[model samples]
Every structure is written in C-alpha cells, then in structure tokens.
Target: MNTVTRPRILVVGAGFAGVECVRRLERKLSPDEADVTLVTPFAYQLYLPLLPQVASGVLTPQSIAVSLRRSKKYRTRIIPGGAIGVDLKSKVCVIRTITDQIVNEPYDYIVLAPGSITRTFDIPGLTDHAFGMKTLAEAAYIRDHVISQLDLADASQDPVERASRLQFVVVGGGYAGTETAACLQRLTHAAVKRYPRLDPGLIKWHLIDIAPKLMPELGEKLGSSAQEILRRRGIEISLGVSIAKAGPEEVTFTDGRVIPTRTLIWTAGVVASPLIATLGAETVKGRLAVAPEMNLPGNDGVFALGDSAAVPDLAKGDGAMCPPTAQHALRQGRHVADNVIASLRGGPMRPYVHKDLGLVVDLGGTDAVSKPLGIELRGVPAQAVARGYHWSALRTNVAKTRVMTNWLLNAVAGDDFVRTGFQARKAARLKDFEYTDAYLTPEQVRAHVEGTARQE
Candidate 1:
C-alpha cells in the first residue's frame, strides 16, 4: 500500500503577522491538505502597542501575551525557537532553540515573518548604556530599573548622584518613545510620594527626537496637542535634537546640551530581522522585497510579510510600499495565507489592498491622541478610542479580561513601585535585551544542516 504525505507549511515568528497567517491557514486548509508549523521563541502573540502600560504597572506582562495554545481551533505545532537563518535553495530554516541548541526545519512552503530588532547607530556608549523597549523582558526590566532608580535616589545623600539617578532621558518621539516617556513619567510622579526624603522636583524626564515634530503621522494639530500634554506633565520635549554621545552618567544631545541621567530608553526605530539577510534576496531599506501578494519573486512557495518584508502599497500606488505597522502586518498575514492556499489549489492569487484606518497614540493616564477612521480625537475621548482599539485587538478573551481587570485595579489602587532587583544584578543594556549576534551566516547554516543530515 502507498501512503500520502501532507505538504508542510512553516511560518516563522509568533508576532501579529505569523500568528494571523497560521490561524487563517488552519481555517482554510485541512490536515490532509497541509500540516502547519510555527517557529517562535514564545508561544504567545504579544500585543506590542500596550507595552508602555505594562512598563508603567498598568497591565501585567501576561495580559498582553496572548497564548497560542489557548485556542482549541489551533492545530499548528509550535516550535520553541527563533529562526536565525533560511536557505531558499534547500528549503530549510535554521533555528536556535531557547536552550541554545541549533536545529534545522524543512518545509514545502515558507512564510518569513520574523519581525524586527531595535535599530541602533554607532554613537559612543549607546549599546552599553541605553535600554531598549522591544520585548516583554525589556519592558519588565525597565519597570524594575525605573523603580530601583527611585529607591537609590531616596537613599543617596550626594546631590549630584541623586540628581543623576532621578533624571530619565528617552530618545525618539514616535509612538513607542512618546508612550514610554509618558507612562514612565507617571510612574515616577506617583512613586515619589512614597519617598519623603527625595525632592519631587528632582524627577526630571527628557523626551528628545531628531524629528521636528512629535508623531508626525498624527498630523500637526494632534501632534502639537500630544507635545503640550507631555509638557504640562513637566516632561521636557526637545524637538530637532538627538543624542550625540551616551555615557554611564550623562548623555550629550546634538544641540550640545548635556543632561545627567542614569536611565536612557532608546525607541528610535526598528530594522528588519537578521534572518532576512540569510535568504540572499533583494531588499528595500533592509526589509525583504516582496510582491503585493507577499511572495518572493522567482522563489516558488516562499513568502515574506510584516516588519521583515517591504510589501508594496497597492492602495497608494506609484510604487509606494506599506509602512511597518500592526494594521498592515495583520492584513498582510491573512492575504499571504490566502495566496499560499491559492498556490496549492491552483487558483488565481489576489493582490492585497487596504486603506489606512488612521493612527492611535496612547500617552498614559487619560491623555491620548487618535485619528480613527479619519476622525480626529484627543484627550479622554482619544484615550478611550486607543484603549478600545487595543482591547478589541487582543486575540483571546482571557487577555481582554485580564487587561480590563488590570485597568480597573490600577484605577482604584496605585502601583506599589516595588523593585524586582533585576537591575541590581545586571544593568539592562541594549545588547543584553536583544540577541543581535545570534544569527548564522549562510555558509554556517548549510554546514549545520549537512552535519545534522549526516548524523541522522
């Protein structure tokens, strides 16, 4: 008797794009038709937009981490690892497991959605001194680090040291940077009341960005409104400026202004994951170039989307590419899945096109700015919209409930501002949070796979 084998579909990264793609594939295809597998370090889809709230103690990390195993409808086998390299010619992906073991995964169809890493420049001391806000660990570390700084400032007698410890600088005026500064500033404001010896005025937050305006996507009026809110909260907003040098004790801005600070949060931008380079394909601005249908050219059964793919923007036309946002990633993921199914079924593939639904910027507390569906909103109304959007986007009912419960608890009860002692054991540096050196070269990937084959 002859046996049949199902076509194996491998999707990398458990982010917004990868998760959506897998879910769509599970619904659209049968077990006999295809077998899906996802390669990710974690088993949850992190709701990244609300990471600021987690850092500020408004929400727990578990609330934002939507579990992949929670859904009974999901049938994809979850591989607990990060894909470090991919061989387009061999149809194999190289993954580094959480235990640091290297393994090779083969697939008939491949979807590359490994997302992105924090973008850093060669500024002196930047990697060693600055903190990042890209992952759950980083957010938790930042919270603990911020609280520890307050504790140290209260205990220190030296005015210089206390001042330096209390001053916090956050670079970039985009959504991540702006929300991080706002949420953390609120945490310090509420936490200082616990320390009677520390002066309340000593806690200074400086938000700087090279961009001329704050959240330019929010438009001029809304952007200015956000800037005013931050300023009203006593946050020093420095536009048209960026860090020239970073040190353990202080940071010097491009405007030649040196500010003493122990905490420096870098959220400027993100670049495509290093895994994209292993494919040896054409890229636009570090992102893998892909068709409107999100497939690699001349590479059958290979697709890329989300932050790692420069998918063309069909809505705008004129050769414009889609911006790296959650909205686009989610849509692209579904579209890619449909296209993959079409490839298998021998159906015509459709191009992806979706209009912008507008932007939302949550500035902590009751302050927010939003342009949902082309309608401008600000203050409490905008805050409601921002939170509403996040609440609805959460993948699971448990996530939504937990997030709602956290918001309620935070509203009535204040944050304890307790330090978890993570920073005391080791400083939270950029390199410490992001494993930038974990990727493998193409030669190494091929050699490892060949070696594994020989062993088997």
Candidate 2:
C-alpha cells in the first residue's frame, strides 16, 4: 500500500473571516484530506463590533474574545504569531511569534484574511499623542485613561486644567468612530454622577470627521437621525473638519479652531494589513486584488478575503469591489473555504455573491439605530435587533452567555467608576498599538525561504 502525503493548508489571521474559513474547512474535509494550520498572535478572535462597548465597561474583554481553541469538530494547529511576509513561488510564510521568534511555515494552499490597522495622516504630534481603538489593549487602556482623566479633573483646583481633562475628542464618522464616540461619551455621562466634586456640564465630547457627513452609508434620514441623537446628548458633531496639529494639551483643527482636550480617540479609517504587499502581486489600493472566487489570479491554490483582499463585487457589477465589512467578510470566508475544497478535489469553484443585510449601530444603553433588511429602527427596538444580531453571530455558547450576562449585569448594577491601572495617565499612541514597521521587506522575505540569508 502506498501512502499519500496530505496537502498542508495554511490560513493567516484569526479575525472573523479566517476563523470562519478554518472551521468550515475542518467540518467539510476529513483528516486524510489535508493538514490545516493557522497563524495569529492571539488564541481568541476578538469580536471587533463589541469593542466600543468593552471600552465603555458595558462588556468585558473576555466576552468579546472568541476562543480559537475549543472547536470540537475540527482541530486546526494554531501558530501564535503574525504573518510578516509570504513567498508565493516557494510556498512559504515568514512569521514573527509573540515571543519575537522568526519561523518559516510551509503551505500547499494559503488563505490571507489578516485584517486592518488604523489609517493615519501626517498631522504633527498626532501619532505621539492620539489613542487608538483597534486592539484589546488600546480599548482597555482608553477606559483606564478616561477614568483617570475624570479623577484628575475632579481633584484639580485650576479651571483650565479641569476643562482640558474633562474634554474628549474622537475622529472618524464610520461605524467604529461613531460608536466609540457615543459609547465613551455615555461612559463619562454615567460616570460623572459618581464623582460628587465633578461638574457634569464640564464633560464634553467632540466627534469630528473630514467627510461631509456622519455615516453616509446609513442614508440621509438614518444618518441625520443618528446625528440628532448625538447632538441631543451634548456631543459636538463636526463634519468636513480635521485636526491639523496635535499638541500635548490642545488640538488645532483645519477649520482654525483649537480645542483644549487631553483625550483624543482615533477610530477613523483603516487600511489593509501589510502582509498582502509581500506577495509582489497586483493590489487594489492596499488590498490584494482577487478574482470573484476570492483566489489570486494565476496563483494556483492561493486565496484571499476579508479586509486584506479587494474581492470583486460580482453582485453589484460595474467593476465594483466589495466593501471591507464584517458582513461581507464572514460570508466570503465560508464561500472561499468551499472554493479551497473544490480546488483540492478537482471540482468547480463558485463566485462569492451576497447582498447587504443592512447596518447596525449600538450607541450603548437603549440608544441605538439600525437598518435591518431595509426596515429602519431606532431607540429600544433597534437596540434589541442590534444586540440580538451580535449575540447570534457569536461563535460559541459561552461567549454568547457571557455577553448576555454582562449586558444584564451592567443594566442592573452599572459600572463602578474605578480605574483598573491597566494603563498610565500618559496615553499610548497609534504607533504603539499598530506595529506597521514590524513587517519584513519583500527582499528579506524572499531571502528567508530561498536560503540566501547568510550571503546577504
């Protein structure tokens, strides 16, 4: 009897798309068919949608972090690292592990789903001073920092210092930015009551975006509704305005207004992961350009999806590419998994097609707005649908239960307004959370697998 070697399938990233793809592949393929491996820096897939809630203390960090280890149906070997580079010709991936170790992983088939980092511009002192909301650490840190600011402001005798400490600024009008501003603003609103010495009127929040409108994808009526809700809550909404320079205690806006604020939360825009560039392949913007089936054209057995790939929007046509959203990424993951299986079995691959399911924006508490299946809803009704969708989408029962329990417990008991000392009073900036400089250059990436390192 001749023994056949099973092909190695390497999936990069542990985001919504990558995790979904690995799970589907495991369920559909038998052990004899292929050996599967995953590359990620963490053991859990952080449910990104609930991160703003986590920052606001409505949800705990663990509740949003879905574990990658506990799948009963499939066992995919997990690599606790970020993929730094890939050599397509040699079929190798260079990874930098959590402990700073360089490792080479070989694969017959590769799926790139590594998500995005916060997109920033050339504003002076922006990177040095601004805080990011893209990671678990950043969210946790922001919570601590926000609480500390309230504490410091309450204790300060000087009015100028108190005003600066009490004021908060958030940039970006998209889902992430809007939710972050709303949620964190609510946190201060609720937290102010606990401090007897603090004046509630001093707590100010400013949400700004360079775009002309706030969440334009939500449509005019819904977007205007969201704006009115925030305005009613005392959040200053500034459209077509952005910071030109960021100082230690003040931010100078392009519209010539300088706001004295100690807190700057940047949830604005995002660019695809740097790993896609290592392939030396064609890319749409920063994202790798792929066929409708989510496979790199002319690159046999290599597939890409999620925020990192500009997958053609076959449903919309007219050379339109699918927007990098979780709704699309989740569907694309399962679809791509089936395509990978088809490639392995010499079967036909199908193009990924899915219409939008609508949008949801949870603004903390019972204040929410959603357009589920084209039905517009706001207030308590929208909140129900939004939370229900997120609860249902959670991969495991434990995560779902924890999230529900957190929601119920928060509603009943509320937050304690105590700083956990997770981060210091001085904020960690954008560059701290996003290690964009960590990626290996294409030449070095090629050298790793080609055994040309020693000569160089």
Candidate 3:
C-alpha cells in the first residue's frame, strides 16, 4: 500500500495578514502537497480603515467586510474559531468555537496571525462608560447611539439633560480616534438638520488625547493641518489632556475641565491579543518576537505575522521591530507564505524589508492630510490621494467598487445619520468584550477539562 503524505498548514485569525497568507499558500502549494486551513472567529476580512465610515452611516456595515468564502482563486477550508492556546511542543492548537466548545487540531506547520485587541487605561469608569471603535457591531452601535442621543436631546424637557445628551466626547487622537471624531461630527452636523429646535453649536464634539498634537505620527506639519481643519469644523481639539473620570452623564478631564456628555468613544490604542501570551514564546513589547523572515526562533515549523508578531526590521538598524500597521502586516503575510513555501521545498527565505511609505489622515468634509513618500499634501487633494490609496490597497475589485460607490453616494446624497437602535441597552464597552486572564488561565482550562472530559 502506498502511504499518503501531506503537510497540514494551520493559520489562526482571518485578519489582513492571515487571509493574505492563506491566499498565497493556496497559490504556491499544490492540492497534493498541503491541506491549508484558516481558523478565525469570523468568515470575513474587515476593512478596518473604513470602519469610521460605517459608524457615520456613510457606508453600510456589509460594505466594509469582504466575504472569505467568496474567494475562488484558492481551495482552502475556513474553520470558525478563535485560537485561545497553542502547544508548540505538541503541534496542537486549542481553539474555542463560537458555541463555547473546545477542539484540538494538530498541524505540521502553524501560522500565528491572531490580531490585536483594544488597549484600555486604568481610568475610573472608562471600562463601563466608554464605547469602543474596534468591531463592526461596535461601530454600528455607535451610529445608533449618537443619533438616538440627538433624538432624545431634541425631545427632552430638562435643559441640563438635553445639553449632556448633545455633547459627545472622543478619547484618543490616533488615526482611529481622529477618523471616528471627524466622521461622527460630520454625521451629527447633517443629522441635526432634521431637528430644527436643536442648536448646532449645542451639539458639541470633543477630541481629547494625552499627546501634544493630533495624529502625531503624521508629523508636525500634516498633523497641525489636520487639527486645524477639525477645529475649523467646530470640533474641539484638546491636546495634552485626557478624561480623568467618566460618569453616566458627565466626564471630567485631566485639566480639571468637566464636560457633561452621554457619549464617550474610546479609540485609545491596541495591544496584542492575550492569545499571544499563551504561545509560550519570547515577546517584545507585547508581540511575539520573530526573526526577519517572520519565523519563530528555536521553532522550525512555526511562523507569525501581523499585529500579533514583533518582526525584526532589517531595513532599520539593530533592535528595531516593524510597527503594527496594515501596510507591514499585508507585506509580512505575503512574505511569510513565500518563506513557508521555501521551507517546504528546501529553498532560502528572504527577510522582510520595506521603507515607511508615509501616513494619511482623512478628516472628513473633503479635508485630509497625507505624506506619501515624504511629499506632504493637504485638503481635497490629500483626501483624494488618501481615499485612492485605500481603494487600491483593497484585495478585491468588489470591495473597491463598493467603497467607491459609497463615496460617490456620500458626495451626491450627503450623509444619512438614521438610527437603527440595535444593541441600545446592552453594555458594549471595551471591558465587556475583553478576554480576561481569569477565564484564559491554565486553572480555568483544567476546571473546564475536568468538567467536560466525560462529556467529550
């Protein structure tokens, strides 16, 4: 009898990196050589850059998500699960299914692409009071929340309560934070036209951060320009400040300035998933440390990429790791696939090297700032380039068309800030979605195994 031999490649997470990695793997490996399986909680690749557009009602939720099952170029299995733990020694990954069932899958080669999660601060009431801008549900909820607040404010008899409802505070001034503020502010501006009684000035939008300027990574010139545009639009830019405390109807900032508001959108920052900590590997600054080839040191069959991995930057001098950005993640994923193929076929692996290709900040209302290849551009031209870059960066034509269509519609029909009121009362805070150590530790796993061993 002839023995059947094939390498099993298991890729965790369906984010930008994992999806692209799987795509390249399917292209490089023949069906007879390997069986590729992509494990993720969702079956869609989320276009995170356009998430603010979804929240602002400029685009539908489905517009920002590309279906994984629709890819016909590659023959790959999509396993729906969030990888919680991995035994590198045993080559077994423990994944938690959506139904809360645990399954152990053995693989010849493992790719760790489990993406990052929102980083929260120790500020009191931030966990309970603030809304996060990470996922589609959160973005959609924010849309409803913002519109509903305006609707309630317009109808309220109490002036203080109405004022509180009208004021919206956004924490953090990073790309996500800035975009969310700009998009949501434009949304509120258009939405208030429906309510004649409400004063446009009364509908306040505050963007606060501990940093000295907005979008500091965009550098001084572009960052200043973006901040100025936002300020001109009546969106208050509070630099070197943070929300000291948050209450149900009011927020106190570090500057001792108190603002009465019902909405607090948190886009502070993101840290590597707790899943990375479970890998039992050396990590640098919360990311799994990997060589320039995107392979785990001391492990031949393991690799990692994207926000979860701290890949060494060969382009930069000694001791520099690639930043957790989509540009690097996408490139890393493709390179990882190439290296993996090389490993399987007895070839050399190339190190990842790419120059920083500037940053772009879309400030809504035909205002944007971009520094592509060190050439800074601002205003409508910058907006054009920022959007064009995003459109070109998308993996598929369908996504590009959909995004362009949304943009065209926005330009023609303006924004529709209608509230769907989904997840109105449910707690959708960052802490609520956080995967705590209490449930992820070995003790919990042991208890779970002990209880479910017989059941299994």
Alpha-carbon local distance difference test for all models: 0.92, 0.91, 0.86
lDDT of the structure predicted as candidate 1: 0.92
Tens-digit lDDT track of model 3 for 271-376: 8988878766799988999888989989988999999899888777688888888888888889999999998888998898988787888878788999998999
Q: Top model by lDDT, which number?
A: 1
TM-score, model 1 to reference = 0.97
lDDT of 1 by residue, 241-351 (tens): 999999999999999999999899999999999998877789999999988889999999999999999998989899998988999989888999999999988998888
Clashes of each: 0, 0, 0
- All candidates' TM-scores? 0.97, 0.97, 0.95
- Go through the candidates in order and give the C-alpha RMSD of each one to the true structure: 1.5, 1.7, 2.3
Cα TM-score of candidate 2: 0.97
Q: Candidate 3: TM-score?
A: 0.95
Give the worst 10-residue stretch by lDDT in candidate 2.
447-456
**Per-residue CA lDDT of candidate 2, range 20-132, in tens?**
99989999998889999999999998989999988898888899998887766567999998999999988889999999998888889999999988888988999998999
- Per-residue lDDT of 47 in model 1: 91
